[model samples]
Target: MLPLSPAPAWAVAGAARVRPGDAAWPSAARWQQLGEQVGGRLIRVQSPLVACRSEPASAACAQLFKAVKNPYFIGDDVALTQTLGWVDAWTSMPSAYAVAARHTSDVVAAVNFAREHRLRLVVKGGGHSYQGTSSAPDSLLVWTRAMNAITLHEAFVAEGCAGQAAPQRAVTVEAGAMWSQVYDAVTTQAGGYVQGGGCMTVGVAGLVQSGGFGSFSKRYGLASGSLLQAEVVTADGQVRIANACTNPELFWGLKGGGGGSLGVVIRLTLRVHELPEDFGAVNFNIKATSPAAFRRLIGRVLDFCSQALIDPHWGEQIRFRRDNTVQVSMVFQGLTRSEAVAVWQPLRDALAREPGDFVVDSSPLSIVSTSARDFWAPTLVKRVLGFIRRDERPGAPRTNVFWPGDQGQAGQVLHGFESAWLPAALLQPNRRDALGDALFAATRHWPVALHFNKGLAGAPAEAIAAARDTAMNPAVLDAFALAILGTQGQPGYPGVAGREPDVALARQQAQALGRAMAELRRLVPDAGAYVSESNYFQPDWQRAFWGANYPRLQAAKRRYDPDGLFFVHHGVGSEDWSADGFSPRT
Candidate 1:
């Protein structure tokens, strides 16, 4: 690894600067001291390569291989997973140190220490950020996973809302709590539910900070919209409470501003909704013998979304693969099996009307009803099915039932991908067909999947307008304007993988997505893109991520973090710093 130059005198004394191979680099004794300072929770991470080198034929190596084989298993542990492995490698180019923050005070101490020592600091919540903002080269990482805690309030009020006439139901979640943990807590422990991400292992703080979207988004609004208050440790090491009536500007920024930009969010208080007794869902799969049939199927599904799925109560996801197959899973909050079919009659009729060759075979359309609590339980069946159906690994022989769980080398190198917003206008039958054709042609040579998440659509006009009240781009609201209201582009989900091991091929795919996104942006130049899911190297990033809100967010960054102490790739005010957390070369 190339060594970074010394810090400027104004930032820190010469003796205080720490960098890999420098005299100031923390030794084991220094690490112990730092741990003591943070209540003895600091941990020195071993390189995965080193961890897997325990006598290649030993049980230890076998167990390590097993643990790393499953992405989900690695992701569940806060220490193992970094959303994009390539970014992690880059971030660790310069030696990295971590502080497992267990309390607000620990974060405050970490911030103060890093600031005093002129060290780049990165806050990690779940470490699932698609852009890998949670990690940085030569930085002190404040890991919040140890601080997981949840508190439910029957009659909750915002920090400064005591005078309000109504007290809302709320849950206060620490930064480290995963979505699944929060889901179980609210549903079983508190008899309530808060609109959250679909992924079980996503961290609440990172999701909410980046303007969360999920199955209930159309009904309850984005997760950020439900935020009532937050406790944050700013760059100056001060812990402050932000709410509608206190530090309101900060509160507004925190709601939708991308994570790791403004401050380290220690805790969040979000409003909750009562859980319905029962909910309905439909799972459908259609296989087409040819690409023409696949296109026809896609057209039909888009037509259905444009017509029958506009109700906020309806939620669904549609996915299409290169093999000319489509799978659609839909859920309705209050509808029963028959009621759902009645509502879906138009789509059913459309499918029936399609030419006989359009579908080679299809599963019978059916609705499965279950109690809300039971319906939300995490199940391994879907994952197992996905594993069974996954395309053969490159260069591997195709097989109906092959498990390569323990066949790979100890350390694996992963790649990153880019996701772009799709304009809502393209949901129209003709436009949808055009968009589908464009995507199919653009990714024909790559193994990328095209997914249309319908559940995140149809957000109420008022809700869209409300997004403007926070730092979140109003374009996100417009993206939800599907079908009759004219289409708008929607932000892409960050978790989707669109990468290739070949750097050149990855760049080619990224460029394709970027070109597509650029065209979509031209349709609404004033709109913004989703920061979390966008290309890290996006041009005109401020406008693409925050739109008209960029100016205000920049001003807030300057005010709250004057020294530019809080920095991340693609974050607000980050342009002033280089990707390696250093001043850019002129």
Candidate 2:
């Protein structure tokens, strides 16, 4: 790979920044304080137990805000007002109060309390779910980030003893454990590894729900497909287990179904594989000048990906991070750099020369990064690069949104949605500057990029079934298709999700891009399947992505979360938006 360079001349010159606007404050506080006067209950978590060898209450609410008592935060607690994550989420200001849950039992208690009291609740795992479904307007958030538990199973794939160990082995991890933590533990302790871990922090539960992606998926399978068992706390507040033995159908549904379905996953168990000593990592960043080269490059990369599926000795990832920049990163399980060159030579040769007015030196590259390729990819480069758009001058208003989540080992695409304000008034141009500043500020660590499967050609039928049916299922596809709109970033972008400071401008962009992408799909072909993280697929698209698992998954939803507590933002059960003050205006 070539040495990193400064932002290109065009990029530096054309810094088209997007910002957020001021927002109307939520009235939940009034409802909470006022409702408490009546027979109603508004749960305001105040920590009971202080482990500081001091105070006490037998039972305690989550102490997340208190636990995060950094001077950086002023008076606002969960309603954190100043942080970048907070600013990003078009939150009018920082959160004032945040609930903290210490364990799964606490999670269950929180859910039941909200259920019993009729309070709207949002579940937060790693704060990485960029869809803002992880957060909401004046709702009680069930924070699960504190329940960080991770266990790597030795019986699953004992090192130096694959055939000698138990037939099947796995790892048990709490839903809150970040992907980074999981990788650290497995690489060192358990001797196993994530499927295709990406470069970010993530919680397994949310990552799986979004039909996780990774470099390894090209060969082995998706992270969701690795599910063996899971401990879930359902709407009724009952902690249930979903797995092959307990609730096999539901377990299958949970595999690739979107998050917040069936229940809040408290724990996840995944099938583990023996660690390879010589996995491969290769990357090439290219800038194309002519349309011919761009088109040919895409075709060639896709061809390589198609071929890699047949050879376990192969893995390929091609990404067009920007209009001019494209990078193809590949991983090989047993193949060496020499063998990989031979396989990639055809694709390389195709891009050797330029057609007309050739200027930008567009090309592909490959290298061996890690000792054992392990789990790695170039998506992070694109994402991180794209994410570094804003300013750092402490005084500016932050990005209008926030989504917190991490990339799991199976090349999890970490997405954390933050809040951003979208005023009811449409003609507000005053917000553009602030919104732009916020977006730039909040995305320092984020990289807004798109990625897809590189190889899945000649694997076992069951493996293919898992990817198509479970991970890339219809319902999940809907969630992923919408994810593209978030390429600029996640929800809370005010202008996204059909809302905006300038409705007309927003509409124009949406329609234009929608038409353009549709045409592209017809030509070069858009990705048929998408991870649930950026799911934008509607019913038809969902059906197309899933093929045949809709009925089975619906049945599972009925059986497990019969009370309608478990649901996606626009899921089957959540169709009744009217009750929640939402209308189908558009």
Candidate 3:
């Protein structure tokens, strides 16, 4: 175990390191002092060392473990729960210290301390990062959970939009604010809404930075597209704003480039849409008695997606589980129930034409007509529908409502599960048959969940092409063409837990995921992946996530974060650093 080292001359007032096996290791006062130095609170959350202790449990160990056990269940302690995948064996490495940041100064102070100490630094927002990029072993964690603040403006003008158009309604959210918080403030306080992630507990900064998708994505655009300005603390400890008229290149990279790679985002301003008067949703549950029937149902849904549902006003999610159960959930804006049904008549007609002996349970397929305020009520979303896991019940129904509250025990349920994404094109008739056959054969030995949607399909070509100006993959905009013969994978949902206590078994499972991803890559070499929901072990992460944009993103990293102060697994310039903050390239 490493011993505590002396502080550097430039260390902050109370900055100190708590190393393993040190005499000061068990002192809560020492941890508290370090937190005070940065003008924030310190928390000793679960770490691998605590989990893998060889000695019999001591009183101190028990207290620490208990304190960290359910850190994410409380909505107010934003710093504690930002690492959703922190429990994974591969991602279980914990920082030596965590600083619950309360302001921009605290972040700047933390960054300086880390640079002086040569310690790895990780920034965390909502901690919903699928790849566990927000955490690492023996690093300094700057948790932004305490910095949540929301400011609403009726007619906000972005720096770039000042001269061209009238001011628009917008909201500026601090880094720690979650999707549910943004949803609540926008719908109620501002009388509007923004297209954001499906999970309310997800951090607004992380989601927008990684190219967010949501129920209103078809109508509005990705959450990233709504970003108007961002206040960031750079690696060099300088606070700056990135927007269309400010540090525009950095602004471009920050949008969809990936979070925790370029800088620590303290605040983000985004455009908001007025609450729609007419909104509708339809739920369908189709059960297949035989394999052929399941195949037919899937094919018809895919056909409906590719043909009849090209409009951005339509949004749907199709979930297929291992038990031959199928569910299709749809939501739309600016349409009444009858109008929505008229638009969806083709899908209903297609289902009528099916010759298979499957039951179409439209009993749950009622249309919802309500205002955005009623549609996105936090009380309704959080208490009733939030925190439901994909593995809870096979073929269970899902809604467009997002709960902006604590996930409680649900956060712990989905730790070690392996997930993958495939493009929407592969769901076509001929290609989908082969893929479904393959998945069915594979699932005979293990359970798998498949989610199908047009998350990035409706954006105009110009919008898709515009992603090239930033770090987001342009391939996302080309879903129609990309889906022709290959498949693109979707991001993982929150709380996909893993139960591999044995390290060896965990490694084996990770290897299997790698092989599976490799096979998927082989099928669709030209298609780019969604960075937010991918596995960290991508063989060629640059090409897999960024495609041709890797070089530009790398340049941005070199220009802004020259010393590599911020490094996330599989993020831009991360190839230069090893898991332990040592250079593998050297």
**Which model, 1 or 3, shows the larger TM-score?**
1
RMSD of each: 8.1, 15.6, 8.0
lDDT of each: 0.62, 0.46, 0.62
Q: After superposing candidate 2, which stretches have Cα over 4 Å from the reference?
A: 1-98, 156-167, 196-199, 286-289, 296-316, 320-326, 353-366, 373-455, 460-462, 465-486, 489-509, 521-531, 535-547, 579-586
Ranking by lDDT: 1, 3, 2
Instruction: Indicate which candidate wins on TM-score.
Output: 1
How many clashes does the backbone of model 3 have? 17
Q: State the lDDT of candidate 1 residue by residue for 1-586, as single tens digits.
A: 1122333333342223356676656576766777888888666654442333344455755564455544334443434543324432232221277788888988998888777767778888766665667756567888887677999988888877789637988999999877767887897556787978755556789989888866656666778888889999998899989988888878888877889888999999998887887766667666666767666666666667677665566764554555666666666775667778787666666665654645432355356666677544533452354322212335521211212321121123323344444556667655776765654443333323322332234666655555657787666654633111011111111222221134554445445455544443444444445676655555677776677787788777767876767777878776666566655322
Evaluated at residue 530, the lDDT of candidate 3 is 72
Model 1 spans > 4 angstroms off: 1-18, 23-33, 50-62, 69-79, 87-95, 353-355, 360-366, 378-416, 427-457, 481-528, 584-586
Cα miss at 366, model 3 (Å)? Answer: 4.8
Q: Pairing residues by index, what is the TM-score of model 2?
A: 0.63
* Candidate 1 collision pairs: 423-489, 424-487, 424-488, 425-487
Residues 67-161 of candidate 3: C-alpha lDDT, one tens digit per residue: 43333333333333333332242444457677788978888878877766556788887777657676676677888877889999888876666
lDDT tens readout by residue for model 2, 529-565: 4434333323343443343564565566667765455
Per-candidate clashes, comma-separated? 4, 80, 17
Q: How many backbone clashes does candidate 2 have?
A: 80
